[model samples]
Target: MNLLYKSSDESATSYICDETGYYLIRLQSKVSEQNYKAAYSAVLESAKTKPYQKIILSVIDDDENPLSVPFSARSWFASYFSPQFYKLAQNQVDVGIVKPKTKLQTNMMHVILGVVEKTNIKINAAYFDKEEEAKEWMKCPT
Candidate 1:
């Protein structure tokens, strides 16, 4: 994995995995809503450099605490950012998400995934307990 971008506060980081050919976004426990947005934006910007077909989002933290965004914010992002992402990838993108540890965080992810799934733009997404699983899934032919 090659580091593509990292937030100023070190709350988030983006990488391009050579093995899976997927853009990976990792969020730390300290990540905020603003930093989360910036992280995705950074990924989209990096996508311009080299088009990618898949993305893996790792909100899982090594410790107990994990990244969690409010339902409203997640909905807003799905409505606002998904379109830009779809366009940036030329109308297609698959996403593999490593689920958070806590129930609350996991529920929030389901909501965001629901919002994204409801959108007109087709953004294929799946959830996994581990980043390795997501990577394996992402590498398969779509």
Candidate 2:
């Protein structure tokens, strides 16, 4: 597995990519609407070349804040790709792994997962736990 790291002003600390069709995104701060959009854009742009089979987003929320309106609404209207880049990827990508740090927040997780499910995205799996688990999941075959 070949992993590369990139930095963004958003919550994410690094973006890891492997030639085997998987991406692991590690978040370092609380996720905000603006940050989410930026991260999504970065990931989407990267995906154009890598064409990952799965994307594991490791969200670490030390504050456990409620989902922002834009993010929630984007999840709600996820069917249309015009709003969120993540949703756009969901339409074509093979899998989406959303991992929340510590004990997962059910509502936020559900919202994202529901959007993925509703969109009929081929999610190999989803998880919420330590960063290691997320990384391992991203490496594993679907």
Candidate 3:
């Protein structure tokens, strides 16, 4: 993977390339709401330049803490009803991938997959017991 951008704090890393089609963002730490927003913005900016077909996010919880209640709620809402982002993703690129590790990670993954299934979005996804497997899956074809 071609490293397009690396966060100064080392909390996250992003890669972009023509072969991949979209920016691949992998968070190496337990991302806070602020961090999430910043990552989103960064991905958006990269999208403008790279013009990828989709975004594949691979996030893992560095602390192994359960998804915060607020984060889970927000993610569920966004996955189901975020019309603006969904529309923006419609033609530009699709967003898909595994959720960060949390107590509710499995449930959240199910919810996300259900949303993608219902919406007819071509989101390829999987769960990994290890980050290496997740990375390999991300690089492999659906």
Candidate 4:
């Protein structure tokens, strides 16, 4: 995994794995609007950097410094980011999300993925408890 972007506060880090053709965005705890956009900019850049269409989104809980996603950030993602991203990928991207530890985080994933589905993008997305499993799943044809 090569580092593509890291948040200023180190709360988020995005990686690109050329081997798996998967872009990984690992977010720790809370997601502020600024941090979300910074990380998403990297995602857009990654799509432009290569035709890679797989994404492994991992949201991990940090017992030491727990944070939550703000409503504004979520709204921004649903309203602005998802549409642009899907359009850029031509609705061909497959996203594999590593399931988070807490119920709240898990619910966040549902909401985000749900919003993505509501966008009417023909993308495949699923949740897994293990990252490797998600990667394997991504390797299969949808």
Candidate 5:
């Protein structure tokens, strides 16, 4: 995995593209609007050459393992409404693993997962705990 890009702002974020063309996005803190734009920009730039429409998103809280943290409602809505997100989510599959340590976190993840699934756009997406399993789910069979 090579460091494709890093957007260190309120949160230290790093995006890595693995050998199988799967993106692994790691975040250390809460996400900001700027962070979302930068992230999407990075992926869009990469997508120009290699269609890495698959992503493994891992967000960590405190000393815990990598997990998914809820973006603000603004970001959530943006994901569904933005043209950039449309480009990313359309015909794309992203694997999300949010190591939820709290009930609220788990609920939030489920809610976001549901929201993503219920979107009008067609995208193959799901949440998982194991990175390997997520990668396996994202790949097309040879």
Candidate 6:
């Protein structure tokens, strides 16, 4: 896979293997609400340029993600993730979230997923505790 973009703060990075349709996103130790948008946007931007837009997002977050999401940020987050997920979910894409351990982010992620499910959102996504398991689900390259 070739690196497509790296954030200036080193909080997020993206890579794509054009030949295989595998897109990898690596989130560093600390991730803010904006970082999530940045990472997802990076994937979407890369997808726009690809010939076929069937992307497999292999999101690796070691489960120890020190997510800095203050309560005041919740409203903005709801607005952000919903539309973002809607656009991606409408496409032929797969999302794999890899969390190696349980952390504050895990519960938050579950809350997000729960809302998506309860609202009957159509997103092909799942959370895995291992990178290999997540990769297997997304058909990510080894």
lDDT for each residue of candidate 2 in 57-91, tens digit (9 for 90 to 100): 66555455532335553453355332243444554
Worst 10 residues of 3 by lDDT: 76-85
- Over 22-134, each residue of candidate 5 has an lDDT whose tens digit, in order, gives 76665555566666556646666666566665666655554353333346633544464333545754565555564545565666656766666666545555666655666
Over all chains combined, what TM-score does candidate 4 have? Answer: 0.85
Candidate 3, 35-122: lDDT as tens digits: 5555555655665555555566665663554433246534643563333334545543345565566656556657656765676554
Of the candidates numbered 1 and 2, which has the greater TM-score value?
1
Among all windows of 10 consecutive residues in model 5, the one with the lowest summed lDDT is 61-70
Query: Sort by lDDT, best first: what order?
Result: 1, 4, 6, 5, 3, 2
On residues 1-142, what C-alpha lDDT tens digit does candidate 1 reach at each position? Answer: 8887787877788888867667988876766677777778777887787678789988866446666554555665698777777787888889898888777777777777777777777777888888889888987836
List candidate 3 stretches off by more than 4 Å. 1-9, 62-73, 76-103, 113-122, 126-142
* Total clashing pairs for each candidate: 0, 0, 1, 2, 3, 0
Once superposed on the true structure, which residue ranges of model 1 sit more than 4 Å away at CA?
A: 70-76
- TM-score head-to-head 1 vs 5, winner: 1
The better candidate by TM-score, 3 or 5, is 5
Considering every candidate listed, which one attains the maximal TM-score?
Answer: 4
Stretches of candidate 4 off by over 4 Å are: 62-66
TM-score of each: 0.83, 0.64, 0.58, 0.85, 0.64, 0.64
Candidate 6, RMSD to the unseen true structure: 4.2
Candidate 3 accuracy as lDDT: 0.55
Candidate-wise lDDT, in order:
0.77, 0.52, 0.55, 0.77, 0.57, 0.57
Model 3 residue pairs with clashes: 66-103
Q: Write the per-residue lDDT of candidate 6 for residues 42-74, one digit (tens) a residue.
A: 666665456333334333444345544444334
Question: Which ten residues in a row are the worst by lDDT in model 6?
Answer: 51-60
The superposed Cα distance between candidate 4 and the true structure at residue 24, in angstroms, equals 0.5
- For candidate 2, the per-residue lDDT at 140 reads 63
| Candidate 4 local lDDT, 29-91, one digit each (tens) | 666778877887788777775757778887777456555777888788788877777777766
